[model samples]
Target: MLKSILSFYYQMQVFMFNWIDVEKLVGLFSFEQYDPVVFGTSFFLFYFFAFLFVFRILAKTKDLKVWTIIFFSIFFYYKAAGIYFLLLVFSAIFNFYIGQWIFNSKNENFRRIIFFASIFVNLGVLVYFKYTNFLLEILTDLQVGQFNPLTIFLPIGISFYTFKAMSYVIEIYMEMLEPVKSLRNFSLFIFFFPNVLMGPIDRASEFLPQIEGDFSVSKEDIGRAVFLIIVGLIKKHVIADYIGLNFVDRVFEVPLRFTGTENLLAIYGYSIQIYCDFSGYTDMALGIALLLGFKMRKNFNFPFMANSVMNYWQRWHMSLSLWLLDYLFKPLQMGLRNMRGFGNAFAVLITFTTVGLWHGANWNFVIFGLIHSVFIIFSMLTKPLRTKFYDKVGLANSKVVNFFQIVFTFHLLMFSGVFFRAISFDSALEVFHQVFTFMKPEVFPQFLESNTFIIILIVLGYIGHFTPQKIVDKITSLITRMPVVMQALLIAVVIWIVIQVKSADIQPFIYFQF
Candidate 1:
């Protein structure tokens, strides 16, 4: 029965991905004759059943069930992760063995050789895929030796999983945790389906240890998982997609066409759009992991509420941020302990710059990263003045200060985001110039009129900021208490609604290509 189930699962995955031949698929699907629902439904159903199969297999792992599931999980990832699947598998195997070798080997030279190779091999992959093109473009303008661009498809989660693999090695080497005994357990940690495509990327210490234990399901846990799934659904389809497709996307595509006020509103809309899109993806990932009886860590903590760049890092993309703090920030801080204040400042700047480059290979990402480094550096330089001002004003936590801090951070982050958003530096500057020139109070109303949903999205987006993670879980948990029949009925209605509003143009997850 499991074999048949697995076979059926694999077959559907192959069929849905008919995109391995993008040209052939496009040729077959003439617009006049195309049906978007057909493709979307195929994917939605494929994932749903795949989840069911994983649940069933995981429920009983007497033989090689875990490995079998891992096989298909990689197979499943291919639909989304694409060529990155090979890189993920290789990185996992590399780290898994290196971690064990380092832990078990007596030969100092061998361990160092393997360990150094693991770091560079993994980082080299990240650099090549994520930054190669960005570098080539810069070199081309400099009239350096002709920058020959070799077209490469970046593996989807290369940055995420590579960082994860690095964390594993560093943790193991540092004696923070022991290495895994089984390759299966290690691979599962690396390629766990829930966090593979988009992640609150888990560490081996936190995630792998749990895998070695028993498989027990809880009703309360089940309830929270269900609720998380629901919340994730609402965030993605209702909030992110609804606003992005209807409003934010339209304005950004043609910034010059809009008035100054419209440009401002459009930027505001994008700010909301990105947060919703990214946070919504993380929520869905977390909720799904919860359903499968795994607890992924929090990735976002209402980052906009944060007043300082340092504080913002604490709140946003927390998994990635925390990963950096542990692996990069702390190490640099500790390493530079002997240096004067200048050393500490330099280390912080360098670390944050690396943080930006980690996102992508673009110069804008570098600038985006550098902008934060500048904020951090400036704040550090005026540390005494900052503390004095706060003490004098009796307003460190005052409402007005909080509001302006938020406003200032929002614009600061927004401009950096614009740099990140534009295809090139010139485009970014054009948007900046137009942003200033297009000014008119009337533009706000016109922009709002054009994208009314976005204004509502912004309000709802902030409301989301206040909800505690615990409550989000508890709420999701409460929903799971409904009878299975009712639960199915609710899901059915949601599926129906999703189908009704579905467009023929199926936009892949924006981050998937990266």
Candidate 2:
């Protein structure tokens, strides 16, 4: 018996040593993966826990907290973008100094020059990375030059970070925000990993102050963070991924293969899928930031509830919309003020066209932008007429009328989503073609039978979306009040559900491409 025990112990030691391959362990930290690290993954969760552990250890030291976060954040970006992470570092350094220069300049003319130069450099980088192939393609089609498309890796989150950087410089130039004194703090603002990929587009004025202040996390913050993260996971993995994989993708890929009813339902599915996909990411981003004791502005606000195209824009992607309004639309409107109503209309067109082009280099995105622009311009022009008609019909304050208005606005946006979600302009047209022409009502029963679960998810998704703010707040409060053990159990249960429901491959967030 003693001899057997000794042999077993020796064997176990050998096995343990063999299992621990130092090279493989180190490779895990290297930037050699084909896919970027994203939220809602086992890998991200593991690293995040490790990050929090280190964060808590250094909680009392402000310098350590800031530097540790910056280090982890840089590592996060390196994993996400590989060598391209250097671009983020460059952007932070470039923008910090530009902001300082803008703020320190005493001469108005020199300040304006510096500001424009900064804008040009910032936009120049964005356009080169995002639009180089696009411009080349356009030139190829136009026969201006026979050019092969150049290979360009769009650094993930370039659009988002570029906007953030630009906002910092612009705000400083306008004297709306003072330049941040510390380069490390400004770097943290840019490199803050949670919102770095897809953002609520944190402003320096708002986020820099938090960095300078003391770090503290309340019980309520913890509860809210857990709630948001869980809800976001459900939205992405349970609803968005499941529905998109099972239904919407099939129909959109080849609308001619399905009936009009299927096509119509697919359109509806896409609308919800995108909302859940995007807002889910925002939720997780916010939750993660909150856990770090930073708060980002809200990004989505139950956009489907909006009763007009304008209101829809206000509710959907609130951060980007506000950015456009403040930076693009307002300036354009000011420049075109002398044109009166035409100016407003033109500004709306120009601003939203930029919105479309900002989304992608494709004509489909342009159409998506144009559709909204036309409706917004129409809404602006017809506001008085609509109000008069509503007042005359005695339906201005009717809940029923408002409900229909919401429905109408939802469908209008859904219509534009065809262009937004399709592979190309022709594919978008094909979707409409099939929807209008392929009236196969005979397949309805079979479709309903086959897609029962998807239909149920869709219904539940909308129901959750339409849940009143009061109810959402109450649920949040209840979660906040729960015992620590209960919260842990809740999180464990939700994560289990996510693991069960998620597809074989994790669905990258929709806005990651943007």
Give TM-scores for every candidate, taking all chains together and pairing residue i with residue i. Answer: 0.86, 0.96
Clash counts per candidate, in order, are: 5, 0
- lDDT for model 2 comes to 0.90
Off by over 4 Å in 1: 1-42, 57-59, 62-65, 81-84, 107-110, 468-474
- Per-residue CA lDDT of model 1 for 260-293, tens digit only, reads 6766666776776677767766776776666566
- The local lDDT score (0 to 100) that residue 304 gets in candidate 2 is 99
Which 10 residues in a row give candidate 2 its minimum summed lDDT? 25-34
Q: lDDT of candidate 1 vs native?
A: 0.72
Top candidate on lDDT is 2
Q: Per-residue lDDT tens digits of candidate 2, residues 18-129? A: 8988677776688864577789888898899999988877556989899889999999988888899999999999999989998888999999999999999999998999
Clashes of 2: 0
